[model samples]
Target: MARTRLLFACLALATPLVPATATAAPLPASGLVLSVRQEMGTFSTTQLSCEPAGGLHKNAKEACAGLAPVEGDFTKMSPGDAMCTMELNPTKATLRGKWRGKKVDFQEVFSNPCVMHVNTGKVFEF
Candidate 1:
């Protein structure tokens, strides 16, 4: 009985010294963030420097961009028979692709303020 009591007392004393751990809340589906370092394109490439916002940029100043869930969830993006064609310009970037028999277009209204040279009319098959 005495040994058991001593163990209980030691446990009680040590309990106060234990640090509390913080639990982080999960990200929302509509606002999910993807930290993409660069345009995940063809197998081989040199490098390009740009970054995106929305808490998904790994390195905002070093070729890190983000994919945010605006109209759809990230899980909804399945890897299938889809072809993405990009058009690069001095002022804008346009992306058009066909996924699941539906045509989709994404336009980047704002160009990279730092001005990274991106190739135009490149088709990436995912």
Candidate 2:
């Protein structure tokens, strides 16, 4: 009984040292923030809200339509047929925010803006 009591005392002390866990809040139903940065330090960003399809994006409806087919998987987006020069301008693309209640965070670097546009299509054309 003395050994059991000692173990219980040790556990009681250790419990206070354990770190508390934090739960992340659930993501919004449908929205995304898209951006692109160029090697020259120029960048642009825009908000995109789907479902009803509206935001600061120039063509939110078209962008959302393209995303729907891929279910928000940017990597799986069909590449467009736009021809691009081989110049290495170094453009970085990013996408973050929620889509259909799912969280999304994506980033990629391309040779140039043309390549980024061809790869991402209307979703990042804002």
TM-score of each: 0.20, 0.74
| Stretches > 4 Å off in candidate 1 | 1-68, 71-90, 111-126
* Alpha-carbon runs more than 4 Å astray in model 2: 1-28
* lDDT, residue 97, candidate 1: 26
Candidate whose lDDT is highest: 2
Over 6-123, each residue of candidate 2 has an lDDT whose tens digit, in order, gives 4355334322232357555433356777778899667677777788787778988888888888888676787898899999899998777777878888888889999988988888
lDDT value, residue 27 of candidate 2: 32
How does residue 67 of candidate 1 score in lDDT?
A: 24
Candidate lDDT (C-alpha), each: 0.27, 0.76
Candidate 2 lDDT trough over 10 residues, lowest sum: 10-19
Q: How many backbone clashes does candidate 2 have?
A: 0
Task: State the lDDT of candidate 1 residue by residue for 2-110, as single tens digits.
Answer: 6456435533432223235755543222211111112433111111112211222233232222222222222223233434345342233333222222344444422
Q: Residue 73 error for model 2, in Å? A: 2.0
